[model samples]
Target: MELTFLGTGAGRPSRLRNVTSAALKLPAPSLSVWLFDAGEGTQHRLLQTPIKLNRIDRIFITHLHGDHVFGLPGLLSTRAYDGGVGPVTIYGPAGLQQMVECLFQLSGTYIGYDIQYVEAVEGVIFDDGNYRVEAAALEHRIPCFGYRVIESPRPGRLDAGKLKEAGVPFGPLYGKLKAGEDITLPDGREIKSSDVTGACIPGRIVTILGDTKPCANAVRLAEHADLLVHEATFAAGLEEKAELYGHSTTVQAAEAAKRAGARKLVMTHFSSRYELEDAVQLVDEARAIFPQTEAAFDGAVFDIPCQC
Candidate 1:
């Protein structure tokens, strides 16, 4: 799995960065993209990358702020025009359906695919056997949410050599062994799966939060996350202003990652006042607290390695 930052600037677009949006690309057998937000010019950003609009199967909106959602209409319209006939599911807070429908009505836009809207609420929002997403209320001026994506653990690899040594031939039996099932040979010899399998591999955890100040929910959602993508809207010394605007400073974002025991952090949603070079200093401030912190910019990709 991997995450790509589409736009990292906060509030508005600048020469250095666009607005807020990110793409979480999952691996097969579900090779699809899930968007965290669709800020202004998001569809344009996707055009710059290899990701196709048709592969975007899910969109999770954190809030209704213009900077965070102004591009939704354009993206949805273009997806149909680009021949995306598959269903698209959107998860967001209350009034999301009404807002999107209102825009479609006013624009006389008709989509070729179905749109499913799920109202944001605390607890598990989506589960498809392989992965599950949990949503929690965050501390933002608006009713924003933070999402924790947990991948299901995979079965351990089968010991082919061990099975061969035990007189088990390669075939469907190997498949059963890999699935943690015991089987008996045609000669009536029994084989235990545990004796020929390695330990189960643990799944990865990724936490992505919307704009918010340092809060308990942010830490809770990021607990033990392999990657925590949080907003650092200001420099270290701008704590007062950050809190006033319901945003987080560089240091605060690091503190939340450290407190949550996250393996690494990528801070985004930077204030437009900071230039491209200023991202280095902002990241340095966060590194002082959590050494694994990184500053996210447009097209930045963070890959999550498998435990195996």
Candidate 2:
């Protein structure tokens, strides 16, 4: 899995950053990508990267802010033009369905593929075979939500030596045994999978939050995450402004990561006033509290290692 920051600016676009958008790349059975917060110019940003628009299967929007949702209609229309055929599911707060419908009506745009819009509350919003996504309400001005993407634990690997010792021949039965099933030997003796398998490898957890202030919900959502992507819209000395604007400062985001026991902290959603050079200082401010902290910029990609 990997995370690519499409736009890292907050509120508006700047020369250094665009807006709030990101792509989570899941490299497994197929090259699947999930987009989070498709801000303005998100399709344009995706064009600049190696991401294919047709491969995006899911989109998660945090709120109804223009900076976070204005690019949806355009992206949907462009995907239709680009020959996208599969269904796409979008999860967001209440009113998302109405908002998309209104945009399509106003623009007279028609999509060719099936687009499923899900109005999400504070609970498990999506669950596939590999991952479970849960949302929690955050303290934002527009009922924003934070998402936790938890990967399911993988089955244990098969021990080839043990399998050979158990007289299990190399065939489809070996596949079944690797899948945690018992296999009967030629002599009718049953061999349990646990006896010939290694320890089950745990999956990684990634938590990404939308625009919000420093709240307990954010901390709880990010607890024990391998990667915590939180918005840091201000510098360290702007705590009062952060609270007033329903956003978090660099220090506050880092403090949340520290409190939640997150292994790594990635701060984005920076205000346009700060330049790219200023991001180093912002990262330093966050790292002062959480040692493994970094600031994300447009086009930045983190290649997460697979646990299995």
Candidate 3:
């Protein structure tokens, strides 16, 4: 799995930053891409990366803020033009379907592919065989949600040595045994899979939050996460402004990471008022409280190696 930041600016676009957008790439056997928050100019930002727009199968919007969803209509239309024949599912708070429908109606745009809109609530929103996504309401101006992405534990490795010791011939049967199936040998002896397999390894967990102030739900969503992507829209000294705007400060984001026991903190969605140097300072402030804090930049990519 990997995360690519397409835009990191909070409210509006600046020379140094764009609006909020991110892509989470999961490798095969599930070659899938997930998009979070398509802000203004997201389609333009995506053009800068090597990612194919047609590969995005799921999109999760945090809220109805202009900066968070302005690019949805254009991106969807472009996807249809680019020969995206597969179905795409979008999950967000209430009114998302109406908003997209209104945009299509106003523009007279017709899509060839099927699009499904799901109204997000506080619970498990999506669950496939390999991963599950859960959401919780955050304290924001609107009904914003933070997502917890948990990968399922992988199967154990095959013990070649044990198979050799048992005099089992190497073939498709080895694969079945490694898959935890009991097999009867040629001599009528039963071989148990657990005897020739190593222990199952656990997968990594990632948490991503939308715009919000310091709240219990943020901490809960980030609990024990391998990586916590939280919004840091203001510096430590601007706590009052952050609260007034229903956003989080650097210190507040750091405190949540520290309390949640997150291994790493990635801060994004910076306010336009902050310069490049000021953004560096904001990261430093968060790192002072939580050592593994980093501020995200446009087109920045982070590789997450498989824990198994």
Candidate 4:
């Protein structure tokens, strides 16, 4: 899977960044896109990337803040205009359906595709066997949530050479062995699945959080995640202000990643006060605590490898 940032600024748009939005592009078999938050100009940002609005089958909103959801109505409308007929599922806090319906009613807009709304709840919100998404409440000014996307573990590749050496015929029996089933040969010998198969490759875990203060839920959602996207809305010196505004400072974000044992940390939702050049200092402060930290900007992309 690959993660693309549409907007990274906090509260409002800046010259270098927009607001808060990110997209996760899933690989083959389920070649679809999942969007996390849709701030203003989110559709415009999608237009710049290769992802189509139709490919976005699921959208998870973190909160009802203007910076997190102001562009949702526009994005849904444009998806219809762009000939997106596939069903779309949106997950968000309470009043999400009412808010969107109210906007559509006032604007006299119509959607051509089917839209499903799932009110945000603290637990496993979605599980399709292949992937599971868990949501947890976050410490923000208002209601906010953090999501953890976990991919299912995949079976290891079958060893055809080892099977051949073991006098097993290369046919449907190999398929059964690959499926973790024991097979009995015509010679009255039994072969275990683990005898030829390699170790299972573990799945990847990604945690994406909304604007939040340093809290336990944030660490819990990000625990041992392959990639953790957390908000660093302020620099180190502005810790008090960040906490007051229900946001995390650069140092605080890195500390969360460290506490959670996250493999990599990508900090977004930066304060507009920091210009492009100032990002170096902000990320440097974070890197002081957690070395595997990066500051996200608009159009930034991070590819999560599938292998364990």
Candidate 5:
């Protein structure tokens, strides 16, 4: 799994950064990409890279802010034009469905693929055999949500040596034994898979939050996450302004990661006032509290290493 930051700026676009948008690509567990937020110009950013719009299976909108969702209609339209054949699911707060429909209806636009809208609330919004996604309400000025994507734990590797020692020959029965099933050998002895298999390998957990101030929900969702993607819309000393604007400062985001015991902190949504050269200071401030902290810019791609 990897994350590509399409836009990492706050409030508006700037020469150095664009608005907030990110792509989480899963090549193993799933052969598709999920977009965190489709801010304005996100499609254009994707155009620069090899990530095709037709491969995006889902788009999660954080809030109704123009910077977060202004490009939704355009992206959806482009996906259809780019040969997106399957249904595309979108999860967001209320009014998301209305906004998409209104734009297409007013413009007399038609799409070839089906669009499924799920109104995000504080609970598990999606669950498949591969992963489970939970949403928590955040402390933004409007109703915003944070998502926790947890990949399902995998079975332990098959122990061929142990199986061989137990007189289980290399045959179709080996598949059943690896699946934790009991099998009778040619000698009429039952062999249990627990005797040969190791412990299950845990999956990865990624927490991505919408624009919000320092809140308990953020910590709850990010608890022990492999990667926590939070917003730092201002420098450390600008806490007052950041709070007033429903945003978080560098230290505050780091503190949230620290409290949550997150393994890594990738901060984004930086204020346009700060230049790329200022990223070191911002990262230094966050690292003072959480050593694994890093600042992300447009086109920054983070490959989440396997824990097992």
Candidate 6:
């Protein structure tokens, strides 16, 4: 899985960064991509990446704020114009459907593709054979939600050379062996999957929270995640204003990642005051608490490696 941050700034778009949007590109099981938080000018940002707009099948909104969702209608309409035939399912909090309808109607923009809406609840919102999605409420100004994406574990590859050496023909028995089932060959030899297959690769877990202060639910959703994308809207020593604005400081976000036991932490939703020149201070503060921290910026891409 590859994560690309389209927008990483907070509140508004600056010359350095846009608003808040990210995309997860899945290569296996499905070739589709999932978007998180389509802030303003998100569609324009998509054009900058190699990801095709038609490959975007799901858009998970973290909140109803204008900075988080103002670009939805524009993106959807543009997708239709670009000949996207697949239906786009949008998952968001309440008033999302209403907000989308209002935008479509008010602007008189018509989209050719179908759009399905899934309201956010504090539980498993979507579960397919490949991935499971969970949501938890976060401490934010409005009804905001944090999303946890859990990828299913994949079976290890079968050793074709070993099987061929074992006098086993490439047939239905290979399927059984991959399923961890024991099978007897024509020579009455019992073969187990463990004898020929390597260890199974573990799946990945990613947690992405909206503009929020550190909370228990956020920690729970982020528990044992491979990557935790938390908002650091302010620098350190601004705890008072950070809490007042329902945002978290750099230390607070690092603390949340440490408490959750996540492997790595990437901080986004930075205040416009801090430019790229100020990244060292922001990264240093978070790294003081969590060593494995990356300060996310526009066009930042992180690749999650599959582990066995």
lDDT of 2 by residue, 1-308 (tens): 99999999999988778899999988677578999999899999999999998899999999999889988888988999877469899999999889888889898998999999888788898888789999999999988999999888777999999888888889998888877788898899999988999887788889999999989989999999999999999999999999999999999999999999999999999998898999899999998899899899999999777566
Worst 10 residues of 6 by lDDT: 192-201
Give lDDT tens digits, candidate 5, residues 140-245.
8999999999988776777888987888888888888766688898889999877878777788899999999999999999999999999999999999999899
- State model 4's lDDT: 0.94
Off by over 4 Å in 4: 166-192
Against the hidden reference, what TM-scores do the models get?
0.96, 0.96, 0.96, 0.94, 0.94, 0.94
Prediction 1 global C-alpha lDDT: 0.94
Tens digit of lDDT per residue, candidate 6, span 58-98?
Answer: 99999998889998888888899877479999999999999
Give the per-residue lDDT digits (tens) of candidate 1, residues 183-289. Answer: 99999989998889999889899999999999999999999999999999999999999989999999999999999999999999999899999989999999999
- How far out, in Å, is residue 175 in model 1? 3.1
Task: Please give the CA lDDT of all the candidate structures.
Answer: 0.94, 0.91, 0.91, 0.94, 0.91, 0.92
TM-score (C-alpha) between model 3 and the true structure: 0.96
On a 0 to 100 scale, what is the lDDT of residue 19 in model 2? Answer: 93
What would you estimate as the lDDT of candidate 6? 0.92
Quote model 5's TM-score: 0.94
Candidates 4 and 5 compared: the better one by lDDT is: 4
Per-residue lDDT of model 4, residues 1-308, tens digit only: 99999999999998899999999998787988999999999999988999998899999999999999999999999989877369999999999999999999999999998999999999999999889999999999899999999999876788878898889898899889887888999999999888988888789999999889999999999999999999999999898999899999999999999999999999999888989899899989999999999999899999999765
What is the Cα-based lDDT of residue 215 in candidate 5?
95
Q: Give the TM-score (vs. native) of candidate 6.
A: 0.94
